[model samples]
Target: MNITVHRPGELSAVDRAAWTALQSRAHLHGSPGLANPFLSPEFTLAIGHERRGVRIAVAREDGEPAGFLPFQRSATGVGRAIGLGISDCQGLVHRPGFDWNARELLRACGLSLWEFDHLVSGQAPFEAHASATFASPVIDLDQGYDTYLRHLRERSPKFIKGTLAKERRLSRDHGAVRYVHDERDPAVLTTLMGWKSAQYRRTGRSDRFAHPWIVRLLRRLFHTRADSFAGVLSVLYAADVPIAAHFGLRSERIHTCWFPAYDPAFAKYSPGLIMHLGMAEGAAADGIAHIDLGRGQKVYKDSLKTRELMVSEGWVALRHPVAFGHRARRAPVRALRNTVQTRPELFEPADKLLKRMGRIRSRGGE
Candidate 1:
């Protein structure tokens, strides 16, 4: 395979078309995970516009396009998945049977190490380097929304009943409740980001929206419209006031849920859950076959997911001093985190401690 590196914006029309074609072929040939919008060229281009260091490695065989790997590189030669912290899916989008050495690819790109958290399945070459794998919860809508609802009811009747009851109560207490699946208003996007930022601080997590690049990227994506990639904003409202909203990326067949938050004032109503249900219904209607909730452990995901997909986390490294140092510095921390995340006994206490820390931090800020 012949590999060439280019900035995401430097890709020619031929390269972009080949990238899209490869993605589509992968999806049609049973790798539905490639249908995620995060893996699309448009997403890479969007990130390139908002942030520096975004590049794509286009591989060709016999002078024909073969594969594409989009990533962000730091000055020290450390590479990460494009939109590393935010992208839910990561992998090389290549034609079936296309194969290349990971180290060779890294060398060609001048990367000493490539780190990824949510590497999608079917990545055989990279799979060998994965230190751990996690189940990514997903809501399958292939059988339609009604079928999924029936399955959900069978699995957790009480959860469904309770959430619906809360919705009724919310409507009665506030004004009539309603949902908008694809909200286009930019102001509403700002409101969603505010809620998400506050929630992040309240839960002892870094506020993603605090970064100007991320904010600009999302705003740009909000207006992006394409057949294979688009940003979808779904909102749940009470009498014209937004209570809960979600901003996620979607392709023709897959909707990957990204950021979701609800007004704490309506916490009693479980507006986030209500908004998810609305998203499911709308996604199904829009011909989306799956709603990928992404890799993580959450009560809501457990309650709503129809099944889970496997995603790996690890780094592919070339035998270089930088790669060795990177692994040495990160391995111990990652091992401890994996242990805590996999064991409920440790995870619960750690979560409580984090919440306490968050409360203290919030108080300090006040």
Candidate 2:
């Protein structure tokens, strides 16, 4: 029942093999939050040249590699689950019957507060006392693309009908629609990142694409391949022109949707929505069961999701010297983040203003 935390890069060959095996046994894995190879020691070391402090947590059931957790602990003793905004899955990966105390793990990592946004569906520990959770919608395109469309019609008749009609309009006017899966084109991925960054600013959110390491990690994923952590880049083209693109990770049977971007010129076509539809069909064709769209309450996710799962997120305060000061200062910020969620409209004006200003600065045009 003893669990130990290790740096992700410190894992040996044997440890890596065991970790991957344990991951395979999970019912529905692949959040692309912290489980991807890009977050692994090999991948991280390859991409994270300057930032090498990310740690890997491994829980051993009597001296065997039972679980592994990947996270980055900051200077303030606060450990943030890696891929915070972008990753959907969070928390440690362990086999059944392995018990862990969240507090201990935080202590082992020399942290007071362990934070995660999409902390997986059933793995988080400290959330029982104070936490919030939500489901990410996913479309089931098992029987076939046509069958999925039928189910979508039955479940969300209006939404399915509208998107389909829009698809038709886009085809009739724009030209024939074409889908590319596992597209080897890095240019498509580059395009997606640009659009995603723009979308982030337009929606008044932090632009993750601005970070060099993160951007490098994604480009690496686009090139690397593994049965468990292969990149599945999807793109949609109209009249031979790229309109929408998404770069996600595929672990054999799970296609965890990640970065997505589309040309704003085709906003009426809703290429992003079309990209998801095409994604489901393509993923199902490749035998991928779950398209882990990650956690969020986006309208398009609701429109395409045929099922949902709830995941929780929160923080744990460490009992140390800096811990007290950290909590005292962070407490108000936590309250603010929670408040921002509850009273989104209150913050929307300010956020929008900031984003508008950024756009204005970038464009330098009226």
Candidate 3:
């Protein structure tokens, strides 16, 4: 087995092609964080330039490529996967039955620990799970949107009816129903950034929108046509005005929902929900299978999901005193998150209070 670390220009065309060819059926595997075309050359370059504590490597066994791992090695001997927060998916991309044994992989990568949040199920074994997140909603778009609606009628009657009714009202009251599939309009993107940043601030989280690298990365992703992480910006318009928009990444087949927003002006019409329904319809028409909504179990996600998939996340450690202590403190918090994730009723009070607080903050700002 030959394990080699690769820089942007260092990777041969064949290596790059073979590496990308191995992307799994899952939508997360196609995200720019793991499989983006921009990630190949530019991402490697940026990581080197910024020295944001990360490294890239590809492992090959018997002349057949085996795995690709992206990690950031902290000074204290902790190596974390790159773009964990920003990435909607995590893990090495390799052949079928890749056999991911977390400890062995960590040892191979020469790291003491590997951490992730939005990890794919059954990928790795982790210690000290930080949280259990929501299951992403998806629609299999192999058949036309109408066919999908049929499935929903049999499976999720209430959800389909409610969303469709709201969509009709939105169009009738607002204006004509219109949609811009793959709308690359920069103005819309800018608006979404503003809203997402506001959401971050109102919740007391660090504002990722303010980071120059992230901003540039998002813009870079918008224009990239490479196979790794092709940006898909879908929009819905009413009367020639965009009412709802979704920014996400796609492989040839899978569309992964990342960020979605709608005009507050048409909030009463549930423009975002309508847009999602339309997008789901479109995905089926486009021969796509799953539209990964990312992790989180919101009321909306639960309504849309066909089923649930459990994701495992935590860390493998080199075992330092401070790191051990950090994990210990996080243990209880993670348990709480897991309990809340498994039982929505238990988490509702806190979630509702937080949302209400956020609304109050937004109102105060206004």
Candidate 4:
């Protein structure tokens, strides 16, 4: 096997074709949700245009492309999975039965350590380095939306009924509620970013939208359309006024739920949940087979999920001084977060504290 690295934009047409073919084959023979759009070259290329650090590692065997790993490298010889925080799935796009080594792969890329928080399952090479694994919930909709709704009804009958009732009440009180599965209006997207930023602040989380690069990335993706990948912005309106919205990426069969937010004034109506239902119904019609809700745990995820996908959080590193220093710097915070997420007793207090801090910050800004 031979390995070579290139900037995302430097990939040749033949390289692009090979990557797409391998991705399609993976979808055909692998698990149902393996056709993640985030893993596509289209995605990495878009990100590379926005982020200069992005690079791709192309591996060849017998003179044919065997695998691809897209990542971001820092000057300090540290690396990360491309779009680590925002990407729902992370793994090398490789042919099945291929043998690879994680550490060696990093060495080839000139990195002492490669960190990832959302490593997709079935990545045997990275499994040994994973400090902890978490359940990433998903809604399988291959049988269509009705089938998915039925599953929800079985799991939480009252929740479904209550949500529908709230939807009806929301419509009557505001205006006739309508849903746009692929809204083209840029203004609505702006509104979504505003709401999302507020949501992050209210939850005591860093507002990703505050970063200009992230905002630009979303805009670029929103206009991108292709068979293997497209950016979808779904919105719900009441009396022609947008109340809730979601912006996610989709391939032919997989819809990855990314940024979702709703007008806080409509919180009583549970607009966020309403927006998801609309997205699911519309996505199924568009040939989407599954919706990846990402790696975090939440009540809504438990109520809506048909299955769970496992993802890992950790770093793969060589025994080098830089790698050791990086680990030492991050270990305390990483350990604390993992402990809280894994323990209900500790998690609740940490969550409350975050909310308290969020409130304080929001009030100060106001």
Candidate 5:
């Protein structure tokens, strides 16, 4: 096998086609996770246009492209999954049975360390390096929306019933409720970002939209049109005013839920939950078989998810000073966070503390 590195934009037409074909084959071979839009070449290309240091490593067997690894390299030679914090699914898009040494791949890309949080399953080369693994919730819609709804009703009848009731009440008190599965208006996207940013600040998390590149990236993706990858903006409105919205990426068979937020003024109506249900219905109708909710535990996810997918988190590093130093500096903090996240007793207290800190921070800013 031979490996070559290139900028995401540098791939030739033939190379791009080969890369996409490999992804399709992987998806068809029972690795449906490869069908995620975040793992598509279009996403990597978009990130390359918005951010620096984006690169793709193409591996060839007998002069034919067999695998692709899209990543970003920092000046310190540390590599990260393309779009890192924002990308929900991360891994090499390789043909079935194609394998490479993790350290060799990193070296070829001139990277001393490679880090990923949501590394997809079936990545055997990177599995041993993962320090932890987490369950990513998913909604299976292979049998279509009605079947999914029946399952949901059986699992959490009250939750679905109450949410639908609130939806009806929301319409009655406001106006007719409407859902747009592919909202194209740019202004609506701006509104959604504002709500998401405020939500981040309220929860003591770093606001992703504050970064210019991420904002530009989302805006660019909003207009992206492709057979395998596209940005989907779904909205829930009452009285023709937007109450809840989500911006996520979708492939032909999978929709990866990303940013979701709602107007706090309508919080009493549970507009977010209503919006999610609308998204599920629309996705299923569009022929999408699964909705990946990403690797985080939330009440809404627990209520809606049909099953879970395992994703690993850790760094693959070469035995070098930079690698050792980076691990030493990051390991303890990661350990503490993992401990808190894995244990509910610690997680709840930590969450409360963060909210308190958020309130203080918000006040100080005001």
Candidate 6:
């Protein structure tokens, strides 16, 4: 096997096509976990256009393109999955039987360390290196929406009835409730960003949209349309008034849910859940077979998910100062988060503290 690195945009059209072909083949022949929009060339290229230091490592076997790994390198020689925080899934796209050592792969890309969270389950070389594994929830749509609803009813009858009742009530009170599955309005996109920013602050998490590059990336993706990958923005409205919105990426077979937010004033009506149901219905109609909700635990995910996919979170490094330095810097934070995730007793207080901080920050107290 031979490896070569290129700036994402530097890849020739032929090379890009080859990379995309590999992704499609992997998704079809490999596990369903490989069917992530984040693994597409369009996504990596869009991110490359918006951010610096983005690189793609192309691996060839017998002079044919066999794999692609897109990532970013920090000045400190620490490498990370491209669009790590925003990308719900991460992995190297490869044809079946393609194999390479993670350390050698990193060295070929000129990095001492590579870190990733949300590493796709069953990713050959990296899975063994993962320090911890977690279940990434997903809503499977292969059996159609009605079948899924029946399953949901069996699992959470009250949740389904309650959410639907809210939807009916919202429509009865506010006028006709409409759901737009693929909204193209830039203003709606802007509104979703604002809501997400506020939601992040309210939850005591870093506001991703506050970073100009992230904002730019979303804007670019919103306008991006392609067969392999496309940006999808779904919205729910009552009497022509937008109540909830979601912006995610999708391929024909998979929809990866990303940023989702709703108007706080309509929280009582559960517009976000309504919007998601609409997304599932519409996505299924559009030929999507799966909706990956991404890694992390949440009550809504547990209620709606028909199944779960495992993802790994950890770092891989060589024996080097920069690699060790990266480990030392992230270890404490990782330990704290892991501990909180495993212990509900600690999580409740941590969540409360975060919410308090979020409230303070929103009020300009930070």
For model 2, residues 4-60, the per-residue Cα lDDT tens digits are 566655668898888777666664443333343334444434433435557777777
Q: How do the residues 220-286 of candidate 6 rate in per-residue lDDT, one tens digit apiece?
A: 9999998878999999999999999999999868998899999999999999998999998998888
**Candidate 2 global lDDT:** 0.72
The sequence of per-residue lDDT tens digits that candidate 1 reaches over residues 1-366 is 799999976899998988888776676787888878899998999989987899999999999988899999999999998988799999999887888898899999999999999999999888889999999999999999999999989989999999999999999999999999999999999999999988888888788888998999999999999887889999999999999999999988899899999999999899999999999999999999899999999999999999999999999998889899999999999999999989999999998888788788888983
Candidate 4 lDDT by residue in tens digits, 1-366: 999999977899999988887777676767444468888898899889888789999999999998899999999989989998888888788887887999899999999999988887888898789988899998888999999999889889999999999999998899899999999998889999999999999999999999999999999999999888899999999999999999999987889999999999999999989889998899899988889999888988887789998988899999999999999998899999888888999999999999999999999994
**lDDT per residue (tens digit) for residues 1-366 in model 3:** 567765445677787677667653324543323332222433444445544666666777778877777677777667665676676666666665555566666666666667776666545444234355445556566566777678778888887888788878877887889777777788888877776777765654467887887877677667766544467778888887877788777765667778787767777877787888878877776666667776776667766666555545677665567567657876688777778767768777766777777677777874
Better of 2 and 3 by lDDT: 2
Q: Count the backbone clashes (under 3 Å) in each candidate.
A: 0, 3, 8, 0, 0, 0
**Residue pairs in candidate 5 whose N, alpha carbon or C atoms collide under 3 angstroms:** none
In angstroms, how far off is 98's CA in candidate 6? 1.1
- With a 3 Å backbone cut-off (N, CA, C), the pairs that clash in candidate 2 are 8-56, 33-87, 112-318
Weakest 10 consecutive residues of candidate 4 by summed lDDT: 26-35
Model 6 misplacement above 4 A: none
RMSD for all candidates, in order, please. Answer: 1.2, 3.3, 4.0, 1.2, 1.1, 1.3
Q: Provide the global lDDT of candidate 1 against the true structure.
A: 0.92
Estimate candidate 3's alpha-carbon lDDT, on a 0 to 1 scale.
Answer: 0.66
Better of 1 and 6 by lDDT: 1
